[model samples]
Target: MSSISDHPLRYKLANELHARPFPSMKAPCSAAYVAIKQPEDAVSRDRAQDLAHLTALLDRHGAPHPQPGATHYYGQIGKYWLKWEQHTEFVTYTAFSDGVVARPFDPAEFDVFPSDWLENAPGQRMTSILLNIVPRPAEDVAVTGSLDEWFVSESLAASEVLDGAAIMAGDFRIDLNGHLRFAVFAGAQTGARRIGRIVQRLCEIETYKTMSMLGFARVRALQPGLNELDTKLTGLMGTMSDERASAEETLHDLLSISAELETLSARSSFRFGATGAYEALVDQRIAALREERFQGRQQFGEFMMRRYAPAMRTVHSAEARLEAMSSRSIRASNLLRTRVDVERSAQNQTLLESMDKRSDLQLRLQRTVEGLSVVAISYYAVSLVGYLLYPLTQATGMSKGMLTALATVPVVLLVWWLVRRLRKSVE
Candidate 1:
C-alpha cells in the first residue's frame, strides 16, 4: 500500500508531515501543505495546487471542514488549518498540536478500532487511513523532530531532527538567525516513469551579500594576514641592503689595510736585519697580517660578488626593463655609479704605467749622451798630442804634414774602435 501510494494529495501530506516537529501532533484525518512564498514564484504556484488538492479531498471525505474566512478545514475525519506569511508558511492540525502539546502519539491512532467500537465506525484499514494522513508532498521536506516522551518542546524548534520516507531527499537548512531556522529545498517527483524528470530545481541564489557580510566582519577585525605579509617582505629587503652595505664597507677597509701593510713591508724587513730570530718574528707578523687581511677581504669580496652585486644587478635590470616603474631614478643612479667606478680605476692604472715608462726612457737617453761626450773630448786631446810629437819624428826624415796626418789617422781609428765598443756595450 505504501509502495503504490503516489497521489498528489498524499505527496503533499507526506512533505508537510515530514516537516512537522511532532508526528504525534499529526491529525488523524486531516493534513495541510503551506508554501510561504511571494507572488509570481514557482513555489507559490506549487503551494496553491497543494492547497486545492487537500481542500478537494477534505470536501469529498467527511473531514473537519474549513471555518468561514480562514484556510481551516473541519470535518468528521480531522481538522486542519494553513496560513501563509511573507515568504513563510505554517500548517497546523488539532492532532498535531495535541501530540506536540502532550507527548508522542498513541499507537492506537494508527491501529484499527475494537470490534465493540465498530458498530457505528466505518469498515476501513487503520494503517491505510493513517498512511493516507501521512501526506507525501511533491516537495522535498525535512522534519525538525519527532515529539517523544523525552523530547522538550523548546528543543523541537532548536533541534534539526527529521523523519518521513525520503523526507530530506533535497532539503537544507536556512540559518536565518541564532538557532531559529527554517528548512529550504526544491520539489520532488514520483516513481519509475518519472525517472528522467528532475525531482528538484536548482536555485542560483545571489550569495554575494552573505559573503560580503563575512568579508566586512573580517575587515573590521583588521586581521594581520595581509598587513603582516607586506611588513615581512619589506623587513627582508631592508635586511638584505644592510648586509650588503656592511660587507662592501668591510671589504673596502680590508683592501686599504692590505695596501698599508704592503707599503710598510720594506721597513719592517729592514728592522729585522740578518738575525734569524728577528727575521722569523717579522715573518710571523707579516704572515698573520696577510692572513687576516686575506680572509677579511676575501670573505667580504666574495659575499658582495656572489650575492650583493648580482642582487643589485638584477634589481636594476628589472627596473630598466619595466615599461613604467615607481622607483626608476634610484636604480639608474646605482647602475651609473657602478660603470663610472670601473672606468676610473682603469684610467688610474694606465696613467701610473705611462709615467713609469717615461722616466725609464729618459734615464737611458741621458746615459747614452754622456758616453758620446766622453769620446768626442778624448779624440780632441789625442789630436793635440800627436801634433806636438810630429816635430820629434822630424829627425826620422818624415814630412811634418804627412807625419801629422798619419798620427791623426791612428788617433781617429783608435777613437772610432773605442766608440764602437762602447756603443755595443751600451746597446
Candidate 2:
C-alpha cells in the first residue's frame, strides 16, 4: 500500500505562516516607515507599479530584486534593511538602520529613502513615521525630559509595556518633517526580537489609526448631503397619507430617494468595512503591548479612548443612519404603492357596478320591445284567420263576427307560446 500524498498547496500554504516575519533589531536603532496608497480606487491599483518602485529602490544599492509578483520582501539595502509589504489597499516600506544618530528623532533619519525615490513613489503617502529606539534611562527625569523636548505634552502618550520590558511614547501628531514620531525605550533585558516586535507594533498602531480616520473624514463630508436627504424623505413621508398629494407622485419620489440611499450604501460599503478592520487592528496592536501607566502619564489605549473612539463612533452612527433611512424609504414606497393599487381597485369596482346597472336597464327595454311585437303580430294573425274562416261561415251558416272572436283567442295563445320558445332558444 502507498502512503497518502500531500495536497498541492500544502507547502505553499504552510510557508505563508512564516512570511513577513517580525524584524530582529536591538536598541539604539531607528526605522523609517511609510505607507503609500492611491488617492482613489486603491484596492484595484496595479501591483506591478508597486513592485517596480520597490525594484527601483533595490537597484540603487545593487540588491537582488524580489521574486516576480511577490507580495512581501525583506533584504539589506546599503546601510539599512528594507521590509516591503503589499496589502489590499496600500503598500508599506519600513527601513531599519543601526546607524549612529546625533540627536533624538532626527529628521535626517528619514533620509534613508532618496528624495527622488520618494517623489516617484507609486502612490501618495498615507502616513510616514520615524521611529527611534534606545535603552531606557536609569533616571525618571531623563525619560520625561526627552518626551517633553520632543513631543507635545497635551497629546503625548507614554506607557510601560510588556511588564516593563520597554516604555513607548508618541504624541500621534505630524511633525515639521511631515512624519509622525514615536520613541521606544527598551529595558536591558529586552532581546533584539522583542525590541523589533515593539517597534513593529507601534508602526501598526499608527498606520491603522490613520487609515481608520479616513472613514471619519468621509462621514464629515457626507453629513450635509445626508441631512438634506433626510429632510426630503421626512417631507415626502408626511405627504404619504395626505389627500392632496397624488399617491403615484409620492411613490415615485420615495423610489428615487430609496435608489439614492442604495447608491450611497454601495459606495460607502468598502470604506466602512475597511475602517472597522483597521480600527480593530489598531486596538489589537495596542493591546498586544499590555500597556501600564508611566509617570502618571496617559497610556496609548487611554489616549485612543479619549481622542479616537469618538470618530469611529461617528462612522458607525452614520452607517446606521444611512441604513435606517434606506429602510424607511423602502417602507414608505411600499405603502404608497399599495394605496395606489387599492384606489385603482376601487375605481374598477365602481365601473363594474355602473356596467351592471346599464345591462339591467337594457335587458328590461329588450323585453318590453319583445312584448309589443308579440301583441302586434297577434292582431294581424286574427284578421287573417277571420278572412279564411268567412268562407267557412258561408258553408256552415255561421256569422263572421263569431269566427273572428273564436280565432282571436287561439291566435293570441299560439303567439305567446311561440314567443316564450324563441326567447328560451336565444338565451
Candidate 3:
C-alpha cells in the first residue's frame, strides 16, 4: 500500500451522509412529532444538556443509550419507534407506532411522549404535530368525505402525490389539542419505504414552515423602529446640503444612525438566513411529494405560494431596505468628512500666509534696529579714542579733532563688519 496518510476527518465525514436514515414505516400507523429549541442562543447551547435530556427519555422507556456525542438516534421505545435528531438550532423527536387510534387524528396518541418528559424538555416546543397514516380506501369519494370531516373545508389542502402512491391532506391549522394535524393514505401496492418518505416530508413541511415564519415575526416587530430610523436619516441627509449646518456634528449623527442600522442587521441576520434555508427545504420537500390536485382541493405547493410566499417577501423587503439605508448613510458620512477636511485645509493655508507676512515685517524691522546699533557703537568708540588722542596731540603737536574724525570712520566700518560676521555665524 502507498504510504500516504488519510485525513483525520475522512471516515467521520463519509459516515455523516448515512447518519440519519429514513424510517421504514408501514401504513395504518400514527406518528407524533415535536421540535424544540431554546428561546435564545440555541446554536451555541451546551450539547451535554441536550444529551442529558435525551438520556432521560431513553431511561424512561428502558431503551439502550445512543453512542456518546451522537447527533441522531433511532431506537425502539416501548411500543413505539423513536427517532431523535439534533439540529443546529433545534432538536426533533418523532415517535411512530403501528395502527391509528379510534378517533381520527386523536390527540391521545401523542401520549407516547410522557407529559412529564415533555415538561422537563431542555427547550420550549417550536412545533408539535400529529400525523395519521392509513391505507387508502377503494373510492376517491370516501377519501373526500374523510378529509371534509377531519379538517376544515376552507383551508383543507389535499393532494395525490408520488403518482398516486399516496394521498395527503392537512389544513395547516392547530386544533384544540394544540397540535397541527396531517392525514396520509397510502396506495395498496405502495412500499413501506415510500410511505415512510411521504410521512417524513409532511413532518418536514410543517416544521420548516413554522421555522420560516419566525423571520416574518421578527420583521414585523422591526417595522416601527425602521420607520423611525428612516425618517431620522432622511432629515439628517437634508441637512447635508445646508451650508449653515456643522459638518462635524452632522457626521456624528450619521455615524450614530449607521451604528444603529448595523446593530439591527447583526441582530436579524441569522434569523433571515435561517428562514431562507428553511423555506427552501420546505419547497424541496413539497416538490418531492410530486403533488397533484385531489377532489378540486388546492395542492400543498399552491397553498404555500398563496399564504406563505407573502410573508417571506416581506422579510426580504425589510432586509433590502436596511442594507440600502446603511449604504446611503455611509456615503453621506464620507462626503461630509471630506467636506470638513477641505474646509480645514483652506483655513490652514490662509493662516500660514498671514504668518509669512508677519515674519517679513519682523525681518525688516530687525535690519533697521541692527543699523542703529552699529552707528551707536561707533559713536561710543570714537568718543573714547578722542579722549586718548587728546594726550597724544599734546605730546606730538597733532590735532585731536582730526584723530577723532579718522577714528570715527574706521570704528563704524569695523562695527558693521563684526555684526555681519556674527549674523553669518548664527545662521
Candidate 4:
C-alpha cells in the first residue's frame, strides 16, 4: 500500500488553534493584567524583546524559561499563575492568584509583577487592569451597594451573564492608581471552566477596546490634514476649468495631492485594519458573555453602544473619507494628465504646420535661384562662342551679325538643357 503524504504545517497549524487555552479558576481569585505595546510601529517591533522581557520576569521567580521563539507561555511563578501571550502589536502578561488581598481592587494586588521587571519592559503599557473574581452576594441590594461603592454609577456596566452564572461590573475608567478595574461575582455552582471563560472574555474585551481606540486617536490627528487636503483638491479641480491655468501646473499639483494621500493611506492601512479586527473581537467577546441586564443597570453591550461604538464608527468614517479623497485625487490627476497631453498635442500640431509652410517657401525660393543661375550661365556661354565663331564668319564670308544671332539660339538651348538635366539628377 502507498502512504499518503501530509502537509508540513498540518499538525502545527491544527495545534495553533488551541495554543492559548483559557485559564481555569474558581471564585475568590484576583488577576493582574497588563498589555504592553511599542509607542511607534508596534506591529513591526522586535518580537525577541518581548520574549526577553518575559524571560526576565520568569528568571526573577526562578521558573524555567519558555522554548525559544515561543509566542505564548503559561507557568507558575511563586504563588501566582502567569499567562503570557505575544500578539501582533502588543504583549500581554496576566498573573492570577487564588485569593484576594485585604482591600478590594487595591493597587498593591498588581504588585505581583516586580516593579523592576515592569520598568525594564520593552514597550509602554497600553493598558493595565486589576480584576477580582468573587462569589455572588445572596441579595441584589448588597450587589448594588458594592457596585456603587466600587464603581462610578454613570459609566458603570453591571451585567448578569451566562444565565445568571455570574455578574460582572466595571466602570470602564482608570482609577487614581492608573489601572482599570473589573469585578466578577460567580455563582457557587459555576464551574471553574465557565468562570475561566468569563474572566477571559472580560480581559479580551478591555484589551480590544483599548486597541480599537488607537484608530480613533489616529483619526483625530488626521482630521486637520484631511480637511486641508480636501480644500486643496477642490481648488485644484476648479482650476481645471480655468482657462488661464496651465494644464501642466494643474497636473503637478494634482500629483502632489495624490502622493500625500498615498503616504497617509500607507501609514494608516495597518492601523485601521488592526483596529477593525480588534473591534470585532471586543464585540464578539462581549456578545459571547450572553449578557442580561443586572438589577436594571447597564449591560456591557449597552455601554459599548453608548461609549465605545461611536469611536469605532468615527474610525470607519475617517477611513471612508480618506478612500474617497484618494479616489478623487486619482481621477483628477488622470483627467489633468489627459488635458496636458491634449494641450501638448495641439502645440505640436501647430508647430508641424508652421514647419511645412516654411519648407514650401524655401522650395519656391530655391527654384527661383535655380532659374536665375541657368540664365546667367547661358549668357556667358553665348559670349564665349561668339568670340570663337567671329573668325569662322570672316573665313566663310557670312555676316557677323547673322553668325552671332544663329549661335546665340543654339548656345542658349544647350545651356538650358544641361541645367535641366543637372537639376533633374539632383532632384
Candidate 5:
C-alpha cells in the first residue's frame, strides 16, 4: 500500500479506475469479456453504432428517448426494459420484461422474422437468453396480431439459437418453453446481474496495475537514500587519494577515513533493507486484495452458473432447497410459539388450584370460630338458668348453690361434646 503512494504510475492508475461509475455512456462496456475479446476494436465506435440503430428503430415507432453515452439500452415497450450490450465475442442482448417474460419468438409467423440474424456462428450453441434477443411490442396487438406472422417455428428452434435479433423487426412472442425457466421473465435483472460480474473483472485489472506501480516506486524511492550513503563513502575515498607528506598524521587520517567508509557501507545496506521491506509490504497488500477478488469471482461464477445453465436443472434445484429450508424454519417457529402458549396456560391453571386451596382453608377456619362462639354463648345461658332454679330448689328443701353449680357444669360439658360431634359430621 505504501509503495502504491511512493510510485507515481501506480497511484495514477488506481485513481483512474476508482474515479467513476458509468464514466462515458457512449463508451464500450468495461467488462473484461468484451474488452479482452477485441482489444484492437474501438470501444466507443462499435457501441455507438449499435445504439444508433436501436435508437433509430425505436424513434421510428415513437418510443422513449435514449440517453447519451448509455453503455446499455433499456426501453419500456411491454412493461420491460430491453437490454443490449457490446461484449467481447459478440453483442449480448437480453430482455428484462415482466417477472415471467418470454423469449422473443412467434410460433404462427415465419417470413416477417429473419432466421440468419439469430443463428449461431458454426459449432457453438446458444445456451442462455443472453445470446438471444427479447422483443417488447408497443401494444398488445403488435404481439398477438401482425407480429405472429414472423419466423417459422421450425427455423429458430431448429437453428443453433446463437446471436440473433428478434425475428420480428421489434415484436416478439412469449416462449412457451420458457415457462419452466424463470429467466424467461423479461427485465434488466438478468443483464444487470451479468454486467455486475464484468465490472468486478475490471477492478482486478486495476488492482494488478496498482501492484506493478508499487514495485517500481519502492526501488525509485530508495535511490536518494543510497545516494546519500555514497556521498559519505566518496569523501573517505577522496582523503585516501590525497598525497600529504606526514607519517603519524597521515596514518591516523587513513584509519579514521577507513572507519567512516565502513559506517557508510553499513548505512547503504540498511537503505537496501528498507526498500526490500517496503516491497514485501506492497506484495502482502496485493495478496490480500487478490484474495478478496477471488471471493468475488467465486460469487460471480455461481451467479452465471445459476443464470445461464440449463434453465430447469440448476436454478430449480437451488429454488427448491431455498424454499424447503424457509418452510422448515417457519414451521419450527410456529411450534415454539404453540409450546410457549401451552406452558402459560398450564401455569395459570396451577395458580388457580393454589388459590382454591387457600379459599377452602379460610372457609374451614370461619366455621370452627362460629362453633366456638355458639358453645361459649350456650354455657353462659345455661349458667343463668341454673342460677334461677337454685333459688326455687332451696324453697323445696334442697342444697340450692351446690345443685345449681353441678347442673351448670354438666350442661357446659354436653355443649362442648355436641360441638365436637357436629364438626366431625361436617368433615
Candidate 6:
C-alpha cells in the first residue's frame, strides 16, 4: 500500500502544545510583565495593529519580526529575553533579564518598554508587574525582615510553593511606581524549568485576577439600569393582572421591557463569560502553586479566599439576578399575549353572533317584500284581463264582473307560484 498522506494541520496541531514554551530562567534574575487590551471590543480588535505594535518594538532593538500571523513571539531584545503572546481579548509581554537590579523591584526595570512607544500603544495596560527571583537565602528570618520593609505587613502573602522548590511573597498592592511587585526565592537545587514555571504562574495569577475583577465592575455599573428596568417590568406585570387594563397595551409594554432586557444581556454576555473563565484560571493557577505557609504568613490561597471570593460571588449573584429578571419578563409577556388572544377570540364570537342576527332580520324583511310584490302583480293582471275580456263577455254572454273575478283567482295564484319559484331558485 502507498504511504498514507498526513493531514494538513497535523504538524501544526502537534506543535501547538509547545508553541508558547515557558521561559527558562535561573535564580538571581528579574522579569517585567505587562498585559494590554482595548477598552472596548477587545476580542474583535484588529490583529494587524497589534502585530504592527509588536513589530515596532522589535525594530527599536533591531530584533527579528515574528511570522505574519503568529500569535506568539520569543526573541532577544537588547539585554532582555522578550516573550509576547496574543490572547482572545488581550496580549501579554514579558521581558526576562539575566540578573536582578541592585534595588529590589526597581521601577526603572519597566523602562525597557519606552514611554513614547507605550503612549502610542493600541490599548491600555491591564496589569504590569516587576518580578525578582533570587537563590533561597539560608537565613529565612533575614528574608522575612526584608519583605516587611518592602511590602505592607498587613497585606503581604508569603508562602512556599511548588512543594517548597521556591518561596514567593507579594502584597498584591500597587506601589508608588504604579507596578505590582513579586519576589521568588528558588531552592539552590531547583531546576531552571521549575523556576520558569513558578514565574509564569505568578504572572498568570495576577493577570487573571485583574481580568476577573472586570466582571465585578461591569455588574456594578449595570445595577442602576437593572433596578430601573425591574421597576418598569414589575409595574407592567401588575397592569396585566388588572381587569381594566387593555390586554393589547399590557402586551406592548411587556414586549418593550423584554427587548430592553435582551439588549442588556447582549451587551454584557461576553464580559460575564470571560470573567468566569478568567476566574477559574486564577483558581487553577493558585492551586497549581501547591502553596504552604511560610513563617505563619498568610498563603496566597488564604488571601484570595478572604478577599477575592466575595467579589466573584457578587458577580455570580448579579448574573443570576439578570437571568431571573429576563425569564420573568418573558413569562409575563407570554401571559399577556394569551390574554390578548382570548379577548380577541371573544370579540370575534360576539361579532359573528351580531352578524347572524342581522342576516335573520334581512331574510324576514325580504320575505315580506316578496309577499307585497305578488299581491300588486296579481291586481294589475286582473285589471288587464277585464279590459281584454270585455268583448268576449258579449259573445259568450258572461258578465264583466264574473270574467274579472275568474281571472283574478288564477292570476293571483300564478303570481304567488312565480314568486315562490324565484325564491326557491335564489335559495
Overlapping backbone residue pairs in candidate 3 total 0
Model 4: residues >4 Å from true position, as ranges? 41-43, 377-427
Q: Candidate order by lDDT, highest to lowest?
A: 2, 6, 4, 3, 5, 1
- Which scores greater on lDDT, model 5 or model 6? 6
* Deviation in Å, model 5, residue 40 alpha carbon: 49
Point out where model 6 deviates above 4 Å.
Answer: 41-43, 379-395
TM-score of each: 0.19, 0.89, 0.94, 0.92, 0.26, 0.94
- Candidate 6: the clashing residue pairs are none
Output the lDDT of residue 208, model 6.
94
Q: How many residue pairs clash in each candidate?
A: 22, 0, 0, 0, 15, 0
Residue 32 error, candidate 2, Å: 0.3
| Candidate 5 lDDT tens digits, 1-427 | 3553466588767865644332111111111111111222233325555556556545544677567765555555333334454432334333332222133332212221123423322212222211122333445354334322443322211110012211111111224532101101112223544333222322332233223333234334444543453454345334433545333343444454345434444434433344344334434432332221211123222322343223323323433433443343344334444544676788899999999999899988977886777678677868787777877774777676666766776777777777778878997
TM-score order, best first, reads: 6, 3, 4, 2, 5, 1
Each prediction's whole-model lDDT (CA): 0.33, 0.92, 0.91, 0.92, 0.38, 0.92
CA error at residue 269 for candidate 6, angstroms: 0.7
Local error of candidate 3 at residue 415 (angstroms): 2.6
For candidate 5, which ten residues in a row score worst on lDDT? 26-35
Residues 202-256 of candidate 2 have per-residue lDDT tens digits of: 9899889989999999999889989999999999999986998899888888899
Shift of residue 394 alpha carbon in model 2, Å: 10
Evaluated against the true structure, the overall lDDT of model 1 is 0.33
